[model samples]
Target: MSEQPPSDCFICRKHRGEISIPGGAIYADDLVYVGHAQIREGQTIAYLGYLMVEPKRHVPDLAALTDEEARALMILVTRLSRALKATENAERVYLFVIGENVHHVHIHVVARYAGAPKEYWGARVDEWPAAPRGGTQEMEAICARLRVYLQKESG
Candidate 1:
């Protein structure tokens, strides 16, 4: 069983269904939740195929994950990366676990498309202005495709 999250924790609130995220949940189990990254307020659209893999438990960082949780997290991250490449036609996927902003153990699974400039590689993949982007409708559609792909993959 997981411990209760503090009221101020964003991931906790998100897991509790208090926070709204775009594309909803692509996949989830007892240990991890996979979903598209959220679109911030006032932003017309967000970079498509950007995803977040987060622990269901309210752990602060990687050091806090149990062995089982760690295993589950990494497996899901790897699978999601595969999903992005297959379903999104991504040339590469960038994994980032910077906990500076949210303090939660969330991994950013960013997709890098083919023909992308070297300047937009790594942590700057989302900064590519010409990258595929979408609002809620496109996000929902993309997530649906991903959900179906992952479901079939798991089967």
Candidate 2:
């Protein structure tokens, strides 16, 4: 198969500050902050590092990932999963890399609970735990809590 040509990838663009960081999330050198969609308690999205971890790289297919990229992605996945589970009090954690829409490599580290609906199981889930629709005030509060949780965990 022919190798894909290099283009200005979206992730790369965001990483280099060419694009504004997406709202509802924070950007760290090691991770991308994806804000909670459902605004549930202890639910958040922590995008793995840019080395092709959870989300496969450049190409949409998983086969495109190099051995090293795949390994790194797995490591990041495990780390994020454990962190979400502990900090969010999640009964289970879900890792997703389906890029049918956005082809960039990114993972959805969802914090799951006991009563989670069956539809969200496995690879078809995206909704956060039950929570009222929150605005900026709510988002900030959740982000702050997550920051604290992550800090404590790292320490």
Candidate 3:
């Protein structure tokens, strides 16, 4: 492996504290940092509960994960999914591990709400309309809720 990950990598910058983490952490440990996804500018359909489970170290992709990281990834993803369902009324959670856009290994855990359009079901859920892409306050309120549920469950 290289002595250090490329400085320009967006995810690496988050790990380096160069960029502030969005939504903060719902649950985190030495292996992972679980937090809400950063809704991009002009983004609408991605709501507050949309989240990411990111590896703390520089694991470039799924193929690069260590044994410990893999186990923690599964546990964190499952816990986050359950928290979303319980607190956010998500009917199902959509999980996708995509590395093409970012070098760091981050798994997206998205909430699929009840009454979501059939056309947007299955592979098309990403196209479904979001409930409300509220501001940081709204999003943080959600993060706080999820954090509470997670703490109880994890404890």
Candidate 4:
């Protein structure tokens, strides 16, 4: 993979600019940012708490991650998963290591709602239909909520 600037990669740019979706980012250190993913215009995936834990550096694969990136990833996933279940009211938090469409290393942490289908569990979780998405104001609110929770945990 060619070198991608923080602004060029989907996850990387999110580390620097306006969050494109609701519940976008909760935390960021020198290595990564815990944020949300972008959706196709017509397609929606999982429920809220659909977060993306992304490395601030434009890393292309998991095997390429530094020791710090790997360690932070472990910490973020464990903490963020709990944060989703507790604060976002998710029964389960689904995680996906997405490097297919984009080359960067990003983790998808999706919240499973009250009646999420078993068929859509595991790898197929991304196929679920997410409706009633919030607009910018709502999105910002969600981000703020997660940010607070993450901050508390980090502190």
Candidate 5:
């Protein structure tokens, strides 16, 4: 789509630096951006290592991505997943692209650590009672470690 994202697009606003998300920006390039997910309103703590990877453009879904954009996005996703494994000691990295709520092409790069039960596999990994949960300081620390790992393993 040649048209720009609407003025109210949350992802677009974030790309423009209007919205300050937790951990700030982990990585960014001409086509892709990687950052920790924002804490929902009223939530005191967030699931640690929940990252969002999206294109710089305001594409609505994967189908809207140009070839180059798609390539960059997936490559970064792979790298971020690896970073999670290395930095967070995550046993498994889950990738999700549910666009129903935000209408943005954002991928959820979730970390599933060891000792997580089978019932908590997939999207429910964060629901495990013992899952790693943290506040802003914790989020920032984990993001800092991930940033270093990603930079060292630069693509």
Candidate 6:
């Protein structure tokens, strides 16, 4: 059998700070980072932090995640999806895990809206236009609202 991957992976490093998302983080737990989607508006990405639900082991694939870990992740994803829809008034939500660069198991919750630009609608994948990055003020507003929503859900 192939040896297990390194315990300290690049994803963990990026989570530490190499890749920072401004106004990006909304919630986090020992096992996940729930934050705004990187490329799309109203999108959210939940990074599965570690393999174990508590012990926080490192693993290369979803099969390494325990059943309970999977279930808890599902619950959190569903809550975030619902919160996004209700808070953002999204038309629909998309969930995916295609880790081409990060090489870690995680989920994306994309809030699809009507009139979303063509660049975001296609499967062929066009380059996202260079729209102005959201400012600190915008991010602060989003973070505040998201925190309220998440706190309410968790209570």
Index of the highest-TM-score prediction = 5
Clash-forming residue pairs, model 1: none
Per-model TM-score, in order, reads 0.92, 0.59, 0.87, 0.81, 0.94, 0.65
Residue 35 displacement in candidate 2 (angstroms):
7.5
Going through the candidates in the order shown, the clash numbers are 0, 1, 0, 1, 0, 0
CA lDDT of each prediction against the hidden true structure: 0.87, 0.50, 0.78, 0.72, 0.88, 0.54
After superposing candidate 5 on the true structure, give the runs of residues whose Cα lies further than 4 Å from its correct spot.
1-4
Residue pairs in clash, model 4: 24-36
Candidate 2 per-residue C-alpha lDDT over 4-119 given as tens digits, one digit per residue, 9 for 90 to 100? 33256655455455655323343244333333433234734322111123332355555776777666666655655665566555677776677665565566666565665887
TM-score, candidate number 6: 0.65
Q: Return the lDDT, model 5, position 101.
A: 79
Better of 5 and 6 by lDDT: 5
> Candidate 2: worst 10 consecutive residues by lDDT?
47-56
Worst 10 residues of 6 by lDDT: 46-55
lDDT of candidate 6 over 38-121, digit per residue (tens):
434554322111011111335545677887767767877777777767676655566766655444566666555555576675
Clashing pairs in 5: none
Q: What is the C-alpha RMSD of each candidate to the true structure, in Å?
A: 3.1, 6.5, 2.6, 2.8, 2.4, 6.6
**By TM-score, is 2 or 3 better?**
3
lDDT of 6 at 33: 63
Q: Write down the TM-score for model 3.
A: 0.87
Report the error of model 2 at residue 82, Å: 1.3
lDDT of 4 by residue, 42-126 (tens): 7543244577787778878899998988998889888888887777787878778868778888888887766667887777665
